[model samples]
Target: MTDSTAFDWRSFLLKWSGEWADSLPESETRDADDEAARQARWLGFPPASEERIAAMEERLGRQLPPSYREFLKVSDGWRNAGGFVWLLAGTGDARWHNNESGLADMYAEHLDEDSGPEERREADLWRRGLQLDVESDVTYVLMDPEDVDDDGEWAVYTWSSWRAEPPERHANFLAFMRDMHREFHSLGARQGDTGPVFANDTTRELDARVEEARLAALGGGWEQAEKALDEAKGYSRPRAAGLGDQIRRLLGKTYMVYFEDLVTDPRYTPELLPPLVAEHARHTNWDDATLRFQLRGADDELMSLAFETLDQVRNGTYRYTPAGPFGEAVDRARELARWGGSDAAWRTLMDALPLWEPLGPDHLAPLAWVADPVLGQLLTPERGRELLSTPRAGRTGTPPSPAANLDPGGLAWLAEPDRGNNRTSYRFVLVEGVHPEELPGRLTDAGGDGGGGMNGDADVHGADTVLNAPMTLWDARHTSTADQREFSSYDDRALVAVGRAGTDWSFAFDDRPAPFHRPRFVSPAAAAGVGTRAMVVWSGLRPGHRKPFFHLSMAEDGAERYAFTYEGGEIRRSGEIPEALEPTRFFGDLAEGAAAEAERPLLEAVTREFGASLPRHALTSGRLHTFTTRSWTRPPGQGETYTVVRRDPPPAQWTTGGHP
Candidate 1:
């Protein structure tokens, strides 16, 4: 979980010793130095008696692996003393299956090629040392496994560890495992098939090899093994050595089948599992666009397979959480639901996603992708034009799209209407939810779908109530304004007139009100119902200012002010401040010469601090002001307002609330 926790495969192997044959006892009678003898000793594959077989099946509540049935007859060559290996049969040629590799053909090529057994023994020892030399921390060296050919000649397994020509085998194996893991991973990725579904070609070949091995046992090549398997397991417990001999000879014929399956058809995908797939299945049909977003893959390589997996969930191949952000995997599925594949694949993927989390606004963007009006803000301006348009953009920037960004654009929306004395003033409100209520707003690359605070400020106004009509907000830092001392601007600010884009931004200037638009703006959520949270970053609180003050409170009956804080109850604001409002840029200190002496008139200090923020000073009531309003809303059509917190003396403060 920390820097100290980087993984070590060696440590993992050491810890997992139980999963290997390390616990098995060695046979002292055989030459420990002999490779053939040592392999025979360890590979005591024997058939279970009938009673034991039944008991094992009953215990596991499943059929025993068929590979164990063929190791019983006496003729099966199992011990090192025996000249033949029953598993390989005579000449080691796997019937119908290509065994033209390794020892199978080598032994046949020149049975007398090596004169003495000592030479063979030494060579085997050398190889064994390479696989388990604890002193050197050395594991098996990568080498090609030798096999037999149809013509009974020796050949090397193309990608066997002993031979390393094919580097692509690892990837192929990984793909196979990933897909197979979907099927039989006990955790329940697959339930109905009772087997594995490997994707990679290597695993497919591996599966074939295993079956070939099993078929060998049935073909009488390992007669002893078949006889051993036919005996009742419980009755033959004491004769294990004899039974094991038969089984060992048949192992090459049978066990290989099971081993190959383990590597090839591993259970990895949820389609092989259950219950979880059941939940995700809903996304496959795609009634809920939010769910579709969670099924798409990061890369396209797995899209087709992923889509197929989704179909399995829909078609009953497997079952799992159909949709959710519950666990890491499920959460990812939720994301893919919107971005999984090509149009058609997406439908399949969407339908396959199971529901793991509750449906709400925060999930809509990923669900709808650019279709989500709010998150569309994340696209680069060029991308935004491309994604938010109807026809999309052409290569030459010619009519990129016929549509506009329609989702939540991070502007703090009003949850309710304003109650005002003048009946003409405006108000602001906040969305009612667990998320914090906002005051300041900005346009940024992050959280455009209303997840976090808006990136910039609400200063792009097109004069009085017509807050910058085009409503285009760019997320930049390091900007200044007329009341530069009062508030810091974005690194850069972009302004555009309402309903007008393309080089027409007369209102793109200093101190413009951004939220006071005359024409009502609709949120993307309103359009799609499901959506994400939008965090607004719009506030210029002078440092050390105490809040909870009703002057800017929306609850008060100042009509417009009353209309604004409709849901202020839920809007999270800094509890209180001791000093006046200072933008975050100043931190806890005032600019040079601004603090001045306490004896200096507070108005002058205010002037130095706020510059030209207000027309009047000294907190005088003589400055009658009109309160403006803004709104905040979530998806599925709901809204309210908040009384704009501004100074009556012109360039006053508008503190949208959230902690710095």
Candidate 2:
């Protein structure tokens, strides 16, 4: 790290010339005249004569700042100061910005009472500041004489139109120039130019420090590694920036910074980006959690690319093939996943993690494991932490079993199987005497348009049309309303798949099956027509726990007939308990035990009595008409909140079954 106060201008300019000479490709260079001048002044021209400098100072009526004066003595002017700057002005070309630019007047018009102190200073300085850059790509570099420090160094400012705020301030000219040099190296690295940016000794020292940090991080000395890497980054060590980010991620300080860099790198894009995107979708699209660090800086083009790539991954059109033994492990894991053995698949991957080598310095093998399609879904936060903590050798144990098949006939596979982790909370609205085709229109305020939907099947139309209408309605509702407080309250938007069960039954399945404070039940007025009936069944349980609080509601002829809730070994009934519901019959051997065991029984009884049986194949493997339900348009009434007054003693059945 060179001290900015003692900056050596000649030596720095010499180093800059070596780095910038071939940093950019031929096509990226300026026109012939500009290129020739840039080459001629690459290391800067001869020193400015003291007589000539004094004459220029007299002409401008102001003495040059110490740093700029010393810089001019070493080089009259510099070329290609950085990626954006073309040339620095010598003593002859330097003058007050007000003499040649109207930027001050333009900025003055935008100032108001709300303008901050920094903004006011920026506007005032633009007119009186000494302009230094002769040419740039819409960038202005200036030195403010009024903002001098005790050392007599004027504060430097760099203003660019692309920035959102006022000009950025630097402590001195040396600081500004150092930043520009780092920018050149950063841009060069991104454009596939990985040449050395510093002297041989400096480069060797930084590289050695970065390698030590890497080893320290792998050895669980993350705090020490992070400190060393951060220090190296100040000298513009490219590997230091990446390794520092990896350390931060390992420490859980950031979520996607390292992965974000990997996705933009072409070397890892094919092998890693897809799984990373899939993992991001699992958190954003499927999980109940709000969107986090996924695609934080992505523009429209990148978002589109990610969305398309995810769709391909989900549809089995895209596959990631790792190299060596890791590829064989992934292949076996994927095969096991195909056969519904999620636990076994995850175990296989975990077993192979120790032998897996990252494709490049930027790659983290553990991230690839947690982001995998088959293995990622089964991984818990604890498991992810373990993987990140020990990147080379992940901990292994007996993983939880895959989600239990809830379909009555055991034929229904999940449409989005990755969501199976959340199957403990399930909800679906069942309607009698409504066709699957007609059900979407009744459930949503907007009628269906016969068009293909997001499921990638043209014939499956109503789901997309129905769901799209509600999003428009929600947007309009929030936009048109005076009170926007309820906007976030209407987060009940859900993906629903509509399919015919038996001859007389049709059901709409909520893809966000997780139970909430208010279940997104179809409005009785919409589902129950002249002679039709609608029923909603929900079970909210934690994974690996059988003590679910079950809810069943039935309505007929636009009137709710009965509601039954079984929770904490007690049954809360409204209206009347139907004779058809015989808990003892379904419970069978466990009839005398805890009510926690009643979930499966209740589901079985409801399936038998209502004749509600959705097609497993249609809901999973085959495409069915699906729509997104906008619960905001017709917000459902908050259902009853039950108090578990009766706490049953632990039953031997629950103990033997390992259910809590």
**Which candidate leads the pack in TM-score?**
2
TM-score, model 1 to reference: 0.19
Model 1: C-alpha RMSD to truth? Answer: 25.5
Q: Which stretches of candidate 2 lie over 4 Å from their true place?
A: 18-42, 45-66, 146-153, 160-169, 183-217, 220-271, 275-309, 312-362, 369-660
Model 1 shows how many backbone clashes? 177
Q: Alpha-carbon error at 181 in model 1, in Å?
A: 22
For model 1, the stretches where C-alpha displacement exceeds 4 angstroms are: 1-428, 431-537, 540-558, 562-660
Candidate 1: residue 446 lDDT (0-100): 24
Give lDDT tens digits, candidate 1, residues 1-660. 321123242332222222112222343243443444344333222334566546544643443222211221111212211111112221111122222223334434443675577445323322221110111111111112222223222221112234433311211211222222222222221123433332233333333443443333323223333344333221222222222222332222222111111111223222121211233453335553333343322234434444555454443222233333333443343232212111222223223323223122111111112111111122233332232221111112222332232222111211112133211212112221211112112221222322122222322321222221111222111211222333222112222111100111100111233332212322211111113221111221222222210111111111111111111112222323224422222222433333212112322332232221211100011101111222222212223333334444665767543223
**Residue 388 error for model 1, in Å?**
44
Candidate 2's TM-score = 0.44
